[model samples]
Target chain A: MSEPVVDTTHEEGETRLSTGGLGRTLLVAAGVVFWGWLLLRWANDWLGGLFVPVGQPFVAPATIESLGASIPGLAGAFDALAFAVEYLPALSEGLWLTLVLTVLGIFFGFFIAVPLSVARVYGNLSKYVSLLYTELLRGTPLLAQLFVLYFGLNISGYVPGFLDGVFANNAAWAALVGFILNSAAYQSEYIRSALQSVDTGQLTAGRAIGLSKVDAIRYVVLPQGLRFAIPGWTNELIYLIKYSSLAAFITVPELFKRANDIASSNFRYTAMFTITAVLYLALVITASRMMNYVEDRTAIPGLGTGSGR
Target chain B: MSDNEHTYLLEVDRVSQSYGTEKVLRDISFEMDRGDVTVLVGPSGSGKSTMLRCVNRLTEIDSGNIYLDGERITGPDVDVNELRKEVGMVFQDFNLFAHLTARQNIMLGPRRVLGLDKEEAGKRADEHLEMVGLTPQADSYPGELSGGQQQRVGIARALAMEPKLMLFDEPTSALDPELIGEVLEVMRDLADRGMTMLVVTHEMSFAREVASEMLFLDGGKIVERGPPEQLFDRPEEDRTASFLRRITEMHS
Candidate 1:
């Protein structure tokens, strides 16, 4: 009854440490804090130079004046946000265009990558076709793809007209084509890695149990592989935020292009760039949180308590 | 039942497997009978698993014919999902779907492949779990079970297929020493109840206790084959004799 485990059901050999166990833990934590403090002390030298008081301190501190008290900067950011809100109808319209472009681009990109990833995995075509597609996509720069679509394809007489005037001109569609193919190049790699990470033994087991190769892939292999790819897929999703900025080059007028237009008109360069940084940061943060939620939900069962193999 | 003995249940004639220039199995041939337990014993990379995988067409044989129930194998033309409905397999790693409960893992094939109604699949899963002595663990995930219990779930999952033939690849080799006996007991019970089985294993006691015929494979070829007593007690080939002695010597 006086054994280490108070509960009879608990395993006897396991022992619990005293509360003071964290004293050494605190010591290690203090060492880390000390190191971080040293690094920050060095960084403050340069950071201090960039930020200086230009107006009255909010609290009128006795020891030192507030350096980050740039009321104009705050007011400018708020004005930028408010200006965006004032242009809500236009920005909302721009928002819709951005969403439409992203959704369409990803959908077409997914379609394109499925065949490409499959070809890469199964070597569906002759060596010439598979190797050609893989090397072409992997070697070419995405910006070059945009340039090719906007300028080269136009000259080469490859114009198609479905989305030619939907976003006010063919430039949007041209951007769509570039973004889709560029994203597909990256996504094909994502899907291929996902598929490869799945155990060959699982496929063999599924087939041995009488599943056809396609059925086995659909039922067993895909489920397992997709689980592993979720984090990587989310990485690609967040990358689309930064990647969407590239659309401005082809005159798609996504967030960055909108901000750029506003910045040029207002002549407040630093303020506009700061506002852009904040918005992009918000987008990436929200996307990351949603992705982490999904990852947490789909985590392997035995792993929740951290004892997973 | 009477016709089971009269015709070979499975026949592999002049089977060959290759990848480009490298041949894996060279014109391998064998026949399996109904209501018989055949043990295929081999060292690693002996093409024993490849032969087992080919029976289910998991590995494509370059040139060969397989006969199941006296019908031509015709690997490409056959409906594999339908074929798998009648032929079950167990793996050394157990390969129990970690996400599903033991009951769900067993029922997955019956639902997806056999087209059994959910209710009927559930009933069958329960019965098969009972068969494998895993009734109490029906709701547990595979990860929650011990290795022997997980292997039993693998057996249950296979049994749910209601297959005519069962193939087991190194089922007990991955299990802990204390756990192997439980899995082998399940296999022995399966054999006693007249399940046609082709097992590849390293457990000598299991082979001796359950097999009606034994094959000793070496270097991708069948080096020796006989009844367990003949193979274990009086092996003709020096390799077979040496292998058996080595296995027994390790056990001692």
Candidate 2:
């Protein structure tokens, strides 16, 4: 019985090790492909497309022919690679728009969130106002919100003249506005929890030191609470990066929209979308690493680690 | 504003407070003059902390009035912030801003409330940090410092405001046995410098040594009040005597 048990444990360990190895190998492959693609694009731009031609689907006919003749299985992989190389420029443009939408949405959302979270935590009757705003925005779908802003509001001429020149088109502005509102609602919830997690003694100590209610919050509570909110804010930012794709429905030519257009035209949805997915994954991984750096830099010695009182 | 000569730095008259149905402080009243070190000692939930909180208007009174520097502070019309500027408080938990260094915590009040420039505030902060014997830990965050050092920073933060009266809500109650002495030493030093302080604590030794007057509270009321020696050696009330005896035994 003991020998059988040992054999079973050995089998389980072997399976676990193989699976872990495979996952690590896949991750390394993804990183290499991402960096290689970035370097190729930069080199192509700097050298004026000496290696790979610009503004056309890059099909290296000689390389594909030779590889296919050697191994019939290599033909499909080469074709997919050609498709990705051809459409990456358009996809890169879309990715830039996606980055802008997510960054600005989160940035503006934060300003609104700070006041909303403060109102929710400290206001008298105004807390209910904040609650209503958060609930209305969070309770609905982001897609529906974009549709309402773009079709209902923008077409109806309700969008103000001040933002006319901010974007190339009205739909992008609508998407930006919708994202700001939706993101603010969610970010305020994170901030509210963060503010509440701070010790009440902090407020007492603040007031005791002759700080007015507002000053105490501005100086003491907010600085500490905002640090606690960093992890939550990072999560919101990642979610926003992915959710920016929803703006595609409203005709905003972001990353997902560009992918959809190219895939639909070529009828190679699987190949086109696989590369698109990789690009997004690369983006998200980069964002999370940056946020991790931010969290570490801003972290106090004992906070969130249960070391400080 | 006339320079009115008042006998007391702080005066609490017939102040009562309750949290919902449970009353924490009932008609509590006290008066402290300049250079006075008054300590309130009692069992837990007996309103010692509440009394200290009420002095600073941190806890609103259900009735009666509190006056600091001969100015009424309890009314709605009075500016609570300005009133608070004359009263500084230290807490049992230290409650130092975790994100800030010891020096920054001390500089906060002077720079924000007192409208002092950065250089002036920094100088004041260093002075208070040196006074608490924490000048070496000036750049350390509260989380990086030991409990005793953190409490000393808390003391320094309060002292930076240069308040007329200082309220301490069990400043050493949260410290470990080894750490408590260092905090008590800082408090003793403050008292020796003629700072008017009102403290709440169960440290009978500290109260006996440094307290000019002691009030024994039980069941939301003062059970005994007199000099520390009177309350400790010859309590007029059995409740005070028994509570003191029990607390002393526990500490020992």
Candidate 3:
């Protein structure tokens, strides 16, 4: 005589269960197959070499020696792994140079951006002036700016002789200045958005507690704003790392320039270029991880979390 | 009107404010002594909150004078930051800094503005936390707190400033009905300690229980003002009587 019971509570879960597990498994399998295809295609030569029988002459040693002697400086297609191993020392020197430039560019750029953003947000006269500066820098290409600083200004005698005496004729100095100013314009925008994202009531709260406007901004507003800007700042930092390659045009002898030198000299363009690209990937990944750690530590619960970039 | 050369703790004379063409407060005048609690009761859009905001100069008066402890705060020469230190204000929305914990919120004013050392600021913060019975929640962020607890922390933050006069602008208006009692209780304790206070609120029961003087404001002017008992039991104006009747009926 008991009425049949229905379990409507479990129906939604059952429907989701039908699609979720199969979808996830298919996605994972597709990812694996895609990466497998990439590895097989890119590493075909190395994998084929590995399958070659040991002590079996694929090519006569005398023939290779004769070729090397006859051509003087000619080499056939490069083994990327072998090229990477042999020239690791030279590549590392250039990598260090790239790291140094990136560090200086981002450090100085961030410091400059802090004041620029503050001026735009809180200053009367400076806000418009900062806006103009930002527009000018952002509107032009970084390459053109570098050219203007290094070739145009350096040669035109527009810059003071004394200033040139301090920083003149140095491609590294020109590249650093160009990169810093360029990144500062971008970083300032990120920081400005962060400052605006902070609740206006926070400023009011600070003032209500008797803090002068400047003190409030310094102690209360900036701390929250800077934390909010971390993700965007890190993105800019990675961009700076990749952009450091452009310094080669000005003869900064950075990672890309060194790789180019080695590649041209050895005629191993594919190997050297691929290795250099991987190095940049490593640098960007390390920097992103470090900043993520910082973001986690400084995160104020419920305030800056879940804010969209 | 009793002018014997003694200054009240707060004095607002003919203060008026307008936005564009709309006058929010007009000729709002009131005075309170060192240990008086004056409650301003009015319907929504009646300029009660604006009047309280004017007292702390959170909103500037268009044409009037506001004196705190006999010092004219309305003068252009007066340092608004310095005046803010002596006059504490609690907002309607419990504007505690979301990034700061309750203790840090209380300590910021004393440390940064008052130049108190960290230890002294921390000590004062705890004292205020205890005053509001929020000592256990001192480390909680505003986002983690209930509405009532957050408002209590707001009060503690103001009290830590040790202002000469306190202003409460609808401090409990944003809280849920069940949570309103806790905030009102903390305020009642402050009134009992003879703190000079000006409050804008719709809690007629709290006003009747705690206010030494009650003001009924309509439009931009005070319609009636007297002791809470006299104003509630025997209104001098028909508008005041009807407003109170409407509020009581709505609450009941």
Candidate 4:
């Protein structure tokens, strides 16, 4: 027998490791300084372009008053805020495209991951196959995978015409497929580990109650495994959101791609890139919060006890 | 029925088991009639628990035949899951599903394996929980309950299956000394109600009061077997006498 188990509630206080608030505040300040320096360096050309027509060198302004004269609306109480708001409408289409792609990619990937993970952990014949699939997908980079499906298969004429008509016409579809395959590889690992973490005694209890092995896994093992997997799955979800920007390499016209086009044309690289960065940050934080809420809701008290400690 | 005829609810014939080169049981055999409560007493490392586990096929025997309700239970053709439905087991550890409530734990076998409707299973869970005197704790999870309550929930969980035979592998061993009686009290009541039970336990007093027969096992074989009073008062074997004396003195 193992050492006698100590009660979980008593150990919780000593076990918790606080994430210091001061460290996070300092990191935030560092990010602000970096972005501010980029903005000041590029402000002259960027502000000049908004006033003058194309192909013209508008006068550079040394003072706020002269800069305000360049654009009519810049004379407002908050010029920077006003400027960011004005340019926001142009990015909406690309932002919407990125959001849809991420949602569908993650949804389909998670759907595939559940069965693949079960097969890997439990199935006799399918276990080896699932193992190879996960290894091949996870071993390579997501960007390379996207390129293979988008350019190698579609543009190089390997894909049949009808299939190409469906997946090749849009870079977004190919990127979605890449995200699905990549995320499934990563998610399946998280799921398999979670399934293994559940106590073996639970399976014995299930079988003793006359449940067949499959039924035992379905009713007893899976619900607990899913709860345990939530924290890891949330990480995969956030990574998928960030990696969606890689779709821009294939001309998907996602948020990052639109930012690139807007910045290059307007000569306002700092402002456009900073806005896109903030939007991505917002998406990541919101997703993390939503998943945390789900983790709390599904947490079974006194179950999987002593694990956190 | 003829005078010579007796219905054997369970038969363990020439049962032998081994782990690697270590022989755990050697040519062990026993027969249990309906409504028999046979308590197996042995020192640690003896094959008492192994024999209990073999009855339900939890531990596969290397060479043996086990018959349950006169049907061959050890053969390849046996549906082990179906066989398990008729042979309920309670572990040394309570082994209740930690996440589920006591009521849910009891209800699971009936609902999932017996194919009882939810309402029917729910009602059966209530009856079984009451049988184990744990009706008040039905809504509590196993983790929240004390060792005794958890073990009772385990008993209720097995009873909800309504099995023909119940195997208890040191059911009270994991419990605290004070908590042992409540579990034993429930077992005594079960015996009174004619549940055929095979129990591996060191609770000799309970065995003396409730057991129809007693088997003293040592070195992976039955050293002595007979009625509890005969084994307790006038053991034929010197090893059995000393072992009984040692345990009795320890208890006193």
Candidate 5:
């Protein structure tokens, strides 16, 4: 029995060691790639005009040809590498647009969600209205919503003068509006559940201490509910970041759109799409880490975490 | 209006309440003078807690009036929030706001309802924390404190409102056997300080020790009520005597 136990332990140790080594290698590779991208971006800013004309793409055809000549039968790899380097700047610009859309969508969605959730939980007649709004947004596809705002509204001539600039031609703004509405509906569900999970006695206690109904909710219920909703809220934000890719269908020049445009033109789908995926992965990991830090900082001692009492 | 209406700090005159067909309180009448500690004692479902809730307008009475300081509080026109400010309540479960520290919980009423500045509210919270012997645990969250300590904080939170009368609804019922004494001790101290209180409780000894008048309620009516010794020792209604015997036996 002891010998079998020892054998099992040794086998587990070997498995762990191999996995750990693989993880370390991946981490080092990721670090090298990240720093190299930053350095390349910096060099491009300073020496880009000398290397490639301002109006043209930086293809580096001579370097690709020299590498292909030196390493026979690896011409495809060299071509893909040169294509990636040429379009990295465009992808970075697209990444910035994606960040802006996700941040604005989630931030504005939070404001709309709080009131909708409160109405859903507490309002008498307004509850039905809030329910209808959430159901309508959540039931439909975000892409269809974008098309309605971008194409349907323009064709119908229903776009207001101020919003004509946004709906008539601005696909990015239309996509952003769709994202905010969709995100608010989903986020309200998360917040409503959080609000409901708080004990009814909390409101009673609030009232017992001379707080009005609205004050009770504003002070006691919302504070606890919002804290509880943080994890779900963060989940919505992550979803928004990935689904921002759908904006590509509406001609938004976001990360995935840029990747699609470059890939279609150059027929380097594999390289272009893979780089876009990596950039998205980086954004998502950074967002979740920042949210995790927020969750840790705001956690109460005796609540959720079970740290006290 | 009666000539002696102003004599009592709280008056529930023939208040009746029902949830659907089941009547929870039926024509329950009671009065408490300033500085009086009146204890409502009864078996489960006897409407002791409901009676206390009616006094604070937490549960509105179906047919009758409740007056605080001789002003009728049971009407549509009455400002319930302002009434609640004067009527502080402590619950059986010690419902301290879970997210806030004990001090902050006490300060919320003063700062929000009374519109006191933060420094004034903080000072008031400290005084009440010390009053409840919870100054050391002032900064701790409700989850960090034991049940007794939480209930103490609950008492302090209510007292910070400087209410004219405090209602305690089975305040010690949810506490463990050992933890009940500390909460009762705080109640006993409040009575000594001449704070008017209406309490619904099953703790017979505390009721006997602190209650100025003991009201034995049954079937949503006060069957017998007088000084604690009269109800506890002297002859009264058979139901009241029997109920007292059972409660004393259980406690002993």
Candidate 6:
């Protein structure tokens, strides 16, 4: 009976205890965390300041009537947001300015990036120049750069009226100045590394066919270099959106500034700021999708598919 | 054929090259006649590739004159691009533009350097692609093809310019064992058609079978130069004999 009871059904192998168990656990854990966060947000809104001992210093959040009433800081935010919304055209006009700034910044940054990349790679000039240029831009903060343009020109009385009038008045122009410098510094490295990745033999091959230095760059080297750089360049595009928020400080009304202005004008601080958060979410999500589309379009299939860099 | 007897197609007189402080080629001198497949055979670091690069002025020779068809290819005054068009090159890696198809790869040189119209370039590309037996693969990118096919595309790309000479720096060196024969066969076909070629390769069989004159380069200098039979089967110098012996022993 013992001999006949011997089992040979151990063929499923070890480590086959079901990986879905771990996945399901992780899924439940994530669901719990997400709902916990949503619950906290909901409880905070429905009941005033969730941690009040009574209706003493902080507003009582447990009462639904108190939740509808505007609290002090939020009351001002609500009023500011309401005022901001009634005049939609003014805020939308700022989009034109933002667009102008983005375009000009990209254009000028391209000019700066191309030459700097080439210089860093092949220029007979000292390492000091490249070092100096990179350090000078990166060492100084962008906000400081905007201030320097504004105040340096103002204090010295050295600026032409037309120049000051255009840049100082237009938040867009000042933003462009700051954005271009920032973009140029970073782009130089991205593009330089890309150019360097191209085999030295490509230059030799071009030379073997008799391409001039300019022609080699224009034809052989630049195309390959730029192809490798596309993904990094897409990253730079996304970064431009977030970093662009700083331009609002100089007075160019991009999405963030408009959102802030809306929240401040409305007494419904929670609702308005939530809408602002959603607007930012939408912008970033769209940018991410667009970048992915571009990457798929431009990348070399096998190499790019793996997301190596 | 005496070395001094004929007018040379390209001549390197006392040419030397070095990177930074280390010298690669020291006092190297050689000459090639028109329509000759002059094979340079040696172990790695012989600087044969560097020597070939100097002819096209692909690499600048530190101190010497490289006369290509009697014109100094190394000078600043001579249009370097013009020199390149006259002398095409095939790399070991077969550096075809990956974004482009085989036909596009071949056509690029003629279209860009020669200023040939798209039609003329296309015609020449087809002719060269046919010559390399890659007409069927003309529309395919370099990435899609096998190593052997890529090399054929490289050969076709080089030939498309209709250059006076083609420099092949280890064309078959990077190929898989099975793929080497197809590339060598293409080289042999090119030799049969009488292309003036300077081939830096280790394929002794290709050299023995196809070369008109074979130069045994060791340590950046030509140790011996003669017909393949004279060099391979009945070698003269100690180094050449030893090199040939090593090759034969390895094969066996």
TM-score per candidate: 0.75, 0.88, 0.82, 0.82, 0.88, 0.78
Regions of candidate 5 where Cα sits further than 4 Å from its true position: A1-83, A155-169, A305-309, B4-6
DockQ of each: 0.34, 0.33, 0.35, 0.42, 0.33, 0.25
lDDT of 2 at A60: 58
How high is the CA lDDT of each candidate model? 0.71, 0.83, 0.80, 0.80, 0.84, 0.71
Candidate 4 ranges beyond 4 A from true positions:
A1-77, A155-169, A304-309, B1-4
Quote the lDDT for B71 in model 1. Answer: 69
User: First chain of model 2: TM-score?
Assistant: 0.80
Q: How well is candidate 1 docked (DockQ)?
A: 0.34
Looking at candidate 6, what is the lDDT of residue A80?
A: 44
Tens-place lDDT digits, model 1, residues A1-309: 001211123122211112364764664465555445333433433355222222222123322212323454565445444544333333333444565676677778877876676666755554356557667866987677777888787622344565345566466777778768777767777877887877677677666666667777777776666566666777776777677777787777876777778778878667666656655655565566566556556655542211131
Q: How would you encode candidate 3's per-residue C-alpha lDDT over B1-252 as one tens digit per residue? A: 335788989888988898889999889888898989999988788898888877777788899998888878986788888999998989889988877888999999999989999999999999998988887777777776788888888999999999999899989878889888889998999999988989988888988999989989888898899999988899999998998888887765
Error of 5 at B34 (Å): 0.5
Docking class of 6: acceptable
Local lDDT at A237 for model 6: 62
* Per-residue error (Å), model 6, residue A175: 1.7
Give the better candidate number (3 or 5) by lDDT. 5
Fold similarity of candidate 4's chain A to the true chain A, as a TM-score: 0.71
What DockQ does candidate 6 score? 0.25
Candidate 6, true inter-chain contacts retained: 0.38
Backbone clash numbers for all candidates listed: 1, 0, 0, 0, 0, 18
Tens digit of per-residue lDDT, candidate 4, span A198-239: 888788889988899899988888877888898888889899
RMSD of 2: 7.8
In terms of docking quality, how is candidate 2 classified? acceptable
Please give, as one word, the docking class of candidate 5: acceptable
Note the residue pairs that clash in candidate 5: none
Off by over 4 Å in 1: A1-100, A126-138, A147-173, A302-309, B1-5, B13-30, B60-65, B74-82, B98-101, B139-141, B219-223, B236-238
> Residues B1-252, candidate 2, lDDT per residue (tens digit)?
123655577788888889999999888888888899999988899998888887777888899888887777888898778877888889889999887988999998899999999999999999998888887778887767888888888988988999888889988888889888888888898999999999998889999999989988888988889999999899999988898899999999
TM-score of chain B of each: 0.95, 0.96, 0.96, 0.97, 0.97, 0.94
lDDT at A63 for candidate 2?
60
Instruction: Report the lDDT tens digits of candidate 3 across residue range A1-309.
Output: 111121112112122212578875774575565445333433443355443332223344445555555554454423333345455545665676688788989899999999899899988999998898889988998888988988887633454555554332358778888888999998999999999898887888788878888888888899889988998988899999999898888887888999999889889798788888977876776687568667766766565642211
